[model samples]
Target: MTQAQSFSSTIFRRKPVVGARAPGQAADEPHLKRSIGTFQLTFFGVGATVGTGIFIVIPEAISMSGPAVILSFLIAGIAAGLAAICYAEMASAVPVSGSSYSYAYATMGEVVAVGIGACLMLEYGVSAAATSIGWGQYLNELINNLFGWSIPNELTAAPWGVDDPGWINLPSVILVVMCGLLLIRGASESALVNTIMVSIKIGVLLLFAAVCFTAFTSSHFSPFMPEGMAGVTSAAAVIFFTFIGLDAVSTAGDEVRNPQKAMPRAIVGALIVVVSIYLLTAVASIGAQAWTEFSPDDEASLSRLANSVTGSTWVGDIIALGAVISIFSVTLVVIYGQTRILFAMGRDGLLPKTFAQVSPKTMVPVNNTVIVCGVIALLGGFVPIDALWDLVSVGTLAAFITVSIGVVILRRTMPDLPRPFKVPGYPVTPVLSVAACVWILSGLAPVTFLFFGLWVAAALLFYFLWGRRHSKLNTGPASSADEVSQ
Candidate 1:
């Protein structure tokens, strides 16, 4: 057979292409300012990780595990941290912006890359929608506390909301649109903004914990494991959504100044800070009231907790206001991450090229941002918040497990490649990362897995029908191939 025929036959083949520069990145292109240090990157991780789930997830988790939800938090954190360590190695090796999608493409086959991209869509896109929904609830709380007026139920709630079914969630849709506009305008979360957001998030949680602790009673701790080990694992699976953004630290690997030393520090630091805050807040909240009082249907549970603990509405108002501000930023960040991931896929020809188009005026993917926000707004405006959180957890867990496996695959395939940061326990760490994620996956409701499987299958179908024929690999030089096998 001719060389051209040989190359064409290998188009769908697996290739190990770590550290390859992404399409559109030019040799002469100006370098991104190497301004992010460990402290700043740590803040980015914390800022992205905290707000989305804590404001709304607490009640859901509590309902599952009672006072033992604290143990769930710890389990989720350890799993997240281990996956993050593996992610650091992948990021340092690949040094690109697509997060797990990019990592999988470099080490695994094109089909797997497309599958992981679908998982990321759920993680970032749906999480943004879920957080926006939570933000609307807090916005209503803040408005009512200050002005004695609330957004009408029809405008503030989704069709399937717990207390009141509404035609649409206008506030959540508005929040998503606002964030979309900012992204189109080239507004990004700089290091300073990240620090400020982190501070606001931590400050509000601390205030809630301190006030709730004042009303703590030992009797609330009885029968801590009310539902036993099953409940604890299930709660951990649900709460795992809170740690989804920890890998944002790895995605910025290329832009950091001294990634080898700084990446590990920032990831570990963010994990510790987030875990500590979650545990403290959980303990304070459960101590202040019986676990049975926690309700998954309550949209503004933290604010209500503050009010109940202090016997005043003003304290709850403070918590609500903080959630409004901080969750707005979280929505923006998650939306930004989603657009970039799609942008990466477009560049690789896994999707239409429209997604890769960069606006001359803004130098960002404007079309991609619009498409992402439109879908997110639809979900936020119509779907109930409770249903979206578990989907986010499932997608994130699958993506993290893929990253861990990618780490082990790259180690065996390219043993001599330069690595800026390595997983501490090497094979053991990656293995455990996979195990933890699998354990959490096992605890998710069967319905969640069914939905996830359908989504992944759809992505693979698109790949076979369209992506393989259009792939950049078919057109690039044979020498450009990263790896090839007969």
Candidate 2:
């Protein structure tokens, strides 16, 4: 039979719900193969979650909640882990690869799937921009420490930063654009590389922890609840943003040897590690100085602590250098996540197929990735980090809440579906997850909530007007939407 005839034949033949495979003619996913193992997955989670928020976000969190910011980390981790568990089941059941976009497509209607895709674009795209700006601060610090050379703060700060006044962050935009090029050129990160990067990040944090411990004193904890209940709640919301990447642990549903066992184990394991590290770092920082003293302008705040401890600039330099490496990986991971969400939408025919079409030349979605990179670069260059963080938090919380609810929806709709690892305590666990996310979301600034509302409205509007009519799933897919047991 000719290729077209074969394609037609394959289209009508559907696989069972379990072990469903991608259509042979749907186009190869990419040139880069799945090389990540469980350990790698764990590291990707740690690497992506460890540095950006902990080192830099603390300044804002400290200012918001005083020393009680540690509680926020715990709260955020619990909610994120719950979401990840829900995601793992859905991902395993669907047997298709993508994040919320893919899961929403198979289980929810095409319209919601597209809306989720839009949400994802915000989550990843702005996140990439956010991570880059955070990266830029450390870059400037590193330069200053190494050679006493630094870019003028004007070039680095967005014109509208809460504290720093600037029109745009030129360096941040440049960094995102560079990462886009790397990804477009088919540059992929390996699990081993991510694991090593995670190690470097953890080591640096440990160094910060150790150095601070040397100067630890109980006096810093005197005003532990200075910001009171409201401050703790508000700080939790901001701090919750840093813990968003903890779900990276569950994205590898297929490659994991024993997904049901591996998925939950890894999720819990990664969460524990992340929380412990955060607690250690927070305690160390708080021990070393007053909780109210953290500077919003200090991007390399943890490294600065090390500097103050040793009275030598070398420790800060080391921290900055490690941040540069680790955050580079973060940019890669965040950008990668953003593109994948769009790609899933494109493949589902909700957005332009071009967005999902993998380029034969690069064996990746070159056009789509490039477009995403361009948009993020613009934001990075123009948007301030503080402005970016709230938006990210809203997107994440909304997505997490949806996933938590999705767990209940899927359980009720497909009760018999094999879930590699069913979330323990089912209805209760999912409910708790949703509540936690909403509580955190409640802490968002009014402007951020308004911005989030506008974005979501745009997505739902697009879905109602356009995405619903173009869903690929309407015709039937080559594989099962939800299939595996976990």
Best by lDDT: 1
Name the lDDT value of residue 443 in candidate 1: 92
Ten contiguous residues with the weakest lDDT in model 2: 16-25
How well is each residue in 1-486 modelled by candidate 2, as lDDT tens digits?
A: 999875443333222333433221134433223445566666656766777777678888877777787787777777787777776666556544456655554455455655666666777777778888888888999999888889887888887767767767877887777777776765234455566778888888888888899999898887778878888888777777665565445444433455545555565667778889888988889889888679776678877878988899998898888888778767776776666566656665667777767666655668877898889888888777767888877777877776777678778767887776778788888898888888887888899978877887898787657765665645654443343122
> What lDDT tens digits, residue by residue, belong to model 1 across residues 1-486?
999876445543554443335533444432233456789878777877888668888898899999999999989989998998888787667766678887777667677788899999888888999999989989998899889999999997788877678989999999999888877765334556657777887898899999998999989999989989999999999889868677667655545667656777777888889888888989999999999999887778999889988889999998998888778877877786787788778877779888867776666778888999999999999998878888999999988999999899888877777787888888999999999999998898899989889988998888888888887666664322245211
How accurate locally is residue 414 in candidate 2, as Cα lDDT from 0 to 100? 70
Q: Residue pairs in steric clash, candidate 1?
A: none
TM-score of each: 0.92, 0.88
State in Å the error of residue 308, model 1.
1.4
